[model samples]
Target chain A: MAATTKGDAGRSDMPEAMGAGIRIVAWNVLSLAIALVIWQLASRAVGSPFFPAPMQIVDAFIQLATRGDTTGHSLWEHSWASIERVLVGFGLGVIFAVPLGLLMGLYPKLYAGTRAVIEPFRFIPPIAWIPLAIIFFSGLTRFAFLIFLGAFFPIFTSTLVGVARVEPIHRKVGIVHGASKLWILRHVVIPTVMPDIMAGMRVGLGTAWLTIVAAELAGGISTGLGRMMINYAELIMVPHVIVGMLLIGLIGFLMNEVLLLIERRLFRWRWQVSL
Target chain B: MHAPISLAKVDVDASHRYGPLTVHDGLKFSVAANEFICICGPSGCGKTTLLDMLAGILVPSSGHVHIDGTPANPKKHSISFVFQEPSTFPWLTVSENVATGLNIKGAPSDQVRSKVASIIDIVGLKGFEDYYPHQISGGMKQRVAIARAFATEADLILMDEPFVSLDQPTREHMQREVLDIWRHMKRTVIFVTHNLEEAVYLADRVLILSAKPARIVAELPIPLQHPRDPLSTEFTEIRSKCVQWLHASH
Candidate 1:
């Protein structure tokens, strides 16, 4: 019976699983539709100015896309402002912290030198840095500082962990092959640590998004998702405020999707094994 | 004709205030150029730890390791190791992993490419040059490990139970592959394993060890030629002799 079942499994599983792509798309559409229907019903029942209907938010979205009335910036411009802060801040954090983390992981002295400073600071939320960041840095630099603080520790800590986690046997392979310490770091340690680094980047970027919203709301930004949401809410444009919040959610989701795509491409070897 | 590597009076102790625990003590051995030697013992008999002391990855509490009759220094001596679990750089393709040692040794570009290609082909990984380690089977990974060992043309090659993790069929195939590579390259090899059959199958000389404090108990030489059949009487006789020595040690 087991032998017959094994023979039948090959014929049964192949064609049905062939179009996984189409099945995924179909499932996603169904899930989204179910969500929208529930949200539409809930909004209509609330019937409050604070809670606008789904259709009202959609209409407000169309209006914002076509015209930038109150702030004199396009909806795209506001979204772009938030995205720019995320990129510059996250980029600065990555460039500065990755190498430092790698170095600290390799050399004990470096880690010992900076451990006291980093351990305390890593615990503080990025939102807490907004007031001090405004004083220390002017305008866009202030927002950048906030985002960088949010992103830096995650990326740095992961890099350190990743480097430390490299198997001893792998390093032994390099040593036995007569590779120098520097050569082993470049060829073996760095490559082995990359997947962990990428995972850290994804997490750090999420924190950057969260911090940017808080920063824009509190730091008195002229144009951004958080600023737009606050400004429209004050003006009693409830639908527009909802539109701003949803836009932020959508844009953050898209950015994460792109990062995941890049990671999947970079680490294709990691997932391709049938064994 | 000269020995490329030798270890004398090596000792590793892990005793506490309460009692005594000596892992290895006074191990003395030598490997002649181009000789394939196997270190066989019961499990946890410090075979791999022995390899580590020889490779300078681990320092024995007291010992002398010599390479080319000089004090052993990794930077001065070229030695290759094939770990029990192959350590191919996950990010590197099969050819790149094969080329790594050669590049570090500063081989010319043309030489690196040809040598890497030839070694990959020799290991029956011709079509897998572009494949990553994760995409291949465990047996294929060990083949790459052996290929890397041979490609560097090191003075000594230390293998720590490289095929013990593999299935019987794959183990037999890899043993043959190792023999084939040894014949072609003619580098000194010290392979460590717990399996007596595996030791008899591959080694020119099997150095059997006692249970703990792990001293070398006996040297059993196999005069059978390459590609020796495991089913043959001569093979079984030698295997039995090695097993008897191990049982006696216990």
Candidate 2:
């Protein structure tokens, strides 16, 4: 009986699973369509300019994409401005944080010595630093400083955790093999901590995105998604503001997806234990 | 055939303490070059601490461990290890893991490549050179660890219950494979385990250690040769002697 059932499983399972998959996708589309219809109806019934319909936002999206915004910067330019700031700030944060984290992890004394200064600043939110950041830095530096403040702690903390979590046995392997201290750092310590560092980077990227948006909105930056949203908000162009918000969401999601892809590629050796 | 590397002769007269708590007191032993020495004891015995001192990872609170007339230092001595836990670097492929020591020693690329290839083949991992540790089974990962230790052609090889994690069949198989590798390579090995049967099966001489503040309670030499049957009278005699020593210490 078991053999017969097993033999039939291959022939019977494929289309049944495929049918379920198709049903799921169809349900997703239907649910989204219903939500959009409700949104459209609510906007019409309210007759408020603030509550723009989905189609109105879509029309605004096309308009912003084809023609320049009020400031003559295309939607792509605004997005590029936001992305460029994020990349610079995030890149700098990773470069500084990972090595410092690794060093601090290896030398507890270093962490101990600096903990007093680092801990308090880490707790202070990056948004709180906007006024000081604007005063201290100008242009890209201001944006980078704010974003760096947001991104730095997560990457650094996780890398520290990664170092702490490094298996003593693995380090013992290096020691027994007579590997030099630098070689152990490069080969054993770095590789062991990579997955943790990658996880930290993912979190840091999200924080960086949020920090850049807030900085752009408040720092009086001339060209960014947040800046464009503010411009529309002042003019009572709610649809364009919605377009900016959605664009921010879409871009943030895509950046996260890219980092996730890289994480998967980097840690292919990680064991996947299933119950 | 290439010349076999000179094996290390170890001499230990060490006592270790942890914050006023003694782990091993006056634990003295010596391993001859090319000898297979297994140390077994009850749980909480300082078998691993002994290995750590020999590997130069920890210094004894009193006395010293010497390898070939000098103080034991991993940097000064040629040593390799197979740990109780899975210690293969997950980022490296099988070939690279095997090649770790040689690469660290700054051996020429060709030498490393050949040594890694031959050792991988010896361990029956030839087809899996590109595979990572996580891609392999538990037994296979241990095999990789074993191959890596041998590939270094180190003078002293320390294994702390390298096969304790495997089930019965795989453990038995690995025991035999390890014996063959030791016979072929002829390095001084200090293997630590808690299993009496495993020690009896593998060691030239089994060192039964007493419980904490651990010291060698008994030495049971297996007069039986390689591929000795566990059912054989001498094999059982040696195993029971080790068990007796363990029970007496407790």
User: Which candidate gets the maximum TM-score versus the true structure?
Assistant: 2
Error of 1 at B53 (Å): 2.6
Q: Write the per-residue lDDT of candidate 1 for residues A162-201, one digit (tens) a residue.
A: 9988888788888877788989888789888887788888
Clashes of each: 0, 0
Instruction: Report lDDT (CA) for all predictions.
Output: 0.80, 0.87
lDDT of 2 at A2: 15
Name the candidate that leads on lDDT: 2
Candidate 2 lDDT over residue span A77-104, tens digit each:
9999999999999999999999999999
The TM-scores that each candidate's chain B achieves against the reference are 0.89, 0.97
- lDDT of residue A165 for candidate 2: 82
Error of 1 at A73 (Å): 2.6
Write the residue-wise lDDT of candidate 1 on B193-221 in tens digits: 88888888898899888877777789888
TM-score of chain A of each: 0.89, 0.87
